[model samples]
Target: MLSQVIRYDGSMTSPSESAPLDGDELETWSALATVLEWLPPVLDVQLQDGWNLTHFEFGVLYALATAEGRSLPMSTLAGFANSTLSRLSRAVVRLEKRDWVRRSTDPEDRRVTIAWLTDSGAEVVASAAPAHADLVRRLVFDSLSAEQAMTLREISRSIAAAISDEGGWRPGR
Candidate 1:
């Protein structure tokens, strides 16, 4: 059983000494906080150390790989990668320098620029994918039973919806 602790005047107090919260509500909030604290660094280390890519860089490559024609408009790519345009521009410049991505004006709209993953970028992503998948499996999926995994997926979807309804951050929006 989980017990609640209350903080009062810089001291910790028992739940009985404090006003109540809905149990499920409290659990949901706590779980979200805990996961946020843990998940990012775990993902970052795998991307940074193993793949020589930052989390955002990995996201960009992954998004391009899954996108139509392995490309997207720079604006859309920024949104998909949850980065500001300037930041994405810098990242794309870096990738361009490495010959991993190419930038070009959209054929139908010269004013718009598109980012396309080069063959080298695709190869890098392919090489990194297995290690990334292994990390995800180890850090997340392997710990849960099949039923629990399904439940987690449902719960995460519901929470994501609630967060989005509240105007929370959304990539590719």
Candidate 2:
């Protein structure tokens, strides 16, 4: 069923067209697909259990924490987080409710909004980072040989580059 150039009814497909995987290709794809399905939820569970943060919320905070002046424009943050503005805004509202983050109109551009991390937010990230990092190491790094880690980084980046410009929802405000 996972073939090209041959349909289930025994008709032929275009030879130049891509077909579904079979044999070793299918096995490799299945393994990669499993990892893709499993990793995010596992990470979310860890963050939610340990820090009361979803993986996405943590990613947003972590991005702000590393940004200069602990602030980034909301739109830019949304891009960096690979999130829709609506989702980022909702998360910002939650973060604001916690007093961990605050928003301000950009001084140079009134139309632009900036998300600023409060001292409390910085402190929270500082407290949470070690545990999160330890979990990452235990789950990912500790299991890989140095070569495999390098290969993984390379393969992942390559795959990302291959699809980075492909079609996807590009939500705007």
Candidate 3:
């Protein structure tokens, strides 16, 4: 539930950007905002309950699992996981404690650190993937028509491009 709404009161408007959202635009933004607010915790619950991992941890593990040789440089992993290096580093530290991931300085370039998914990490990812996929399908795909799904993909890509251009990570970059 959206607990608070600071509706436009015309108190801080400029000449060029003075107009508040139109009715259709307001409704669209509200729905999108609600989804943004709501989706993560739902995804988190499945990962936490079934695999004892947070969504970001699963993303890190999944990203490494799909990378060549089950590893990536720290910066590259952070990009793919759509996280900052510091955040990724903290998650990597937690995964290391579980012996699910390991970090090593690159043999040739000493400054570059690499994260590798251990065999144990692979096992956890393999175990969790299907259930995660099923939940996603049930919650998202099942609710959308094919055309709507395609539209969603395009919209997501456009939004991703815009956000990435503003200095956010773009997966597959």
Candidate 4:
């Protein structure tokens, strides 16, 4: 007769004897988990402390700044920011209030609205860009030698491609 016991940590201590995952698979899983845990906070801290922006806000501004005519359709901006339309709209409202952005209907297409980066927005982004790049280098690239950085980039791209193929992934989706 077997009796089941629950552990205090909410995990089962007694094993049913499942097969173990391969070492590479385990490493991949662990690395992904660690990245998920670390990436968001790092972004949040750098944006908030360094730039007075949230990650999403920075993304929206960055997209518009780099876009043609410093503008983009709201739908495209949403995709670029990896955000829902509603969320992007709200952020746009906040940016407008700050005089950092403007919204207007596209002259050629009344159904489409365009987000434009204002002079203030451009100034803010320009000021923040160096700090943001420095943070990225410190957090990611600076620790690696040039060859290692190149190798890591290749490995990351390959992994990204494989994951995209397996999961039907979309950039910013």
Candidate 5:
């Protein structure tokens, strides 16, 4: 059963005990929400301006580039890219038009479709990687001490796991 939303004064109650967020909790959550809304466009702008690739396109290519045999089944690639299969297919089609990726069926299991990064695709990813890394470092890591970076890694992984567990999401499902 779900609890009813309760409002006291101008503030809504928290899920538990109809408690409102205290000042510190409210500030932390607001900051996180702002970052979530702001970061994706910043990343997209950098990638789009430099490489003409949306972050999603770059992610798909990057995943294939780092994979063994430079290939994965379309379903697996979609999962790795955090995209639905239909969206991945459309992106793959665009990449195919650019001669960056190729698609084929698995010989042993014809029902399965696979995607492979072409030599050209490998070249593109290789060329784009340094710039991407630089931007990521500048935007994300430049301000952090090594200790803070490690702490962030631990915190982010815990949060991600919690969200995934609650949503029943598996990266390669």
Candidate 6:
């Protein structure tokens, strides 16, 4: 349970006042929240407009394109893409329709299915990489000072670690 009070001033009482975000902390949290809300769709639009792919689909294809022999077991690929098997299955089906990827039974494990990037898929990913990279650089890196960039990386890693520890949501696991 939690509680707060607002006095005559237009300020929020911190939760129980035992712990509270100070002004700077509140500002930082708000900024992070805004970025989290806005960044994904911006990213998805760039991929969709320029490459005819959603970010998740591109991510799946990109993962396969970078894997050994341009292939991975479906389960492994889902983990790498940070997606559920069902969602990854849907994305793979769309990619297969585009001839960008193909599915096969793993030779060493008949029970396992593998996703492989087709030649056309590899070509598409290669072509899309530059534009996507440029957009990311512009939106994220271009605004940061070197020190800020390093701080952002460190902060992100720390947050990811905390999430993994608390929620058991490690990617590529």
Model 2 clash pairs? none
Model 1 misplacement above 4 A = 1-24, 170-173
Report each candidate's C-alpha RMSD, comma-separated, in the order given.
7.6, 5.4, 6.0, 7.0, 5.3, 6.6
Ranking the candidates on TM-score from highest down gives: 3, 2, 5, 6, 1, 4
TM-score for candidate 5, please give it. Answer: 0.85
Ranking by lDDT: 3, 6, 5, 2, 1, 4
Q: Could you estimate the TM-score for every candidate?
A: 0.78, 0.86, 0.86, 0.78, 0.85, 0.85
What is the C-alpha lDDT profile of model 6 across 1-173, one tens digit per residue?
A: 54666543344676666666779989999999999999999999999998899999988988988898999999999888887888889899999999999999988889999999999999999999989999899999999998999999999999878766655554433
- What's the lDDT for all of these models? 0.84, 0.86, 0.88, 0.84, 0.87, 0.88
lDDT of 1: 0.84
Candidate 4's error at 171, in angstroms? 8.6
Q: Write model 4 residue lDDT over 1-173, tens digit each, in one string.
A: 43443443344544454546679989987986897799778887888997678878988999999999999999999888767788899999989998999999999999999999999999989988888889889877888899999998898899768865655434334
**What's the count of clashing pairs in each model shown?**
0, 0, 0, 0, 0, 0
As for TM-score, the candidate ahead, 4 or 6, is 6
**Residue by residue across 7-58, what tens digits does model 5's lDDT show?**
4223454477646777998999898789889888988898889878888899
Q: What lDDT score is found at residue 105 in candidate 2?
A: 100
Candidate 2 structure quality by residue, lDDT tens digits, 59-119? 8889999999999999999999989999999998988988889999999999999999999
Q: Give the winner by TM-score: 1 or 2.
A: 2
Q: Residue by residue across 1-173, what tens digits does model 1's lDDT show?
A: 43755332244556766566668978987987898899988898888897678777888888998898999999999887777888899888888887878999999999999999999999989999889889889988999999999999999899778866766655433
Screening candidate 3 with a backbone cut-off below 3 angstroms (N, C-alpha, C), the clashing residue pairs are none
Residue 70 C-alpha lDDT in model 1? 95
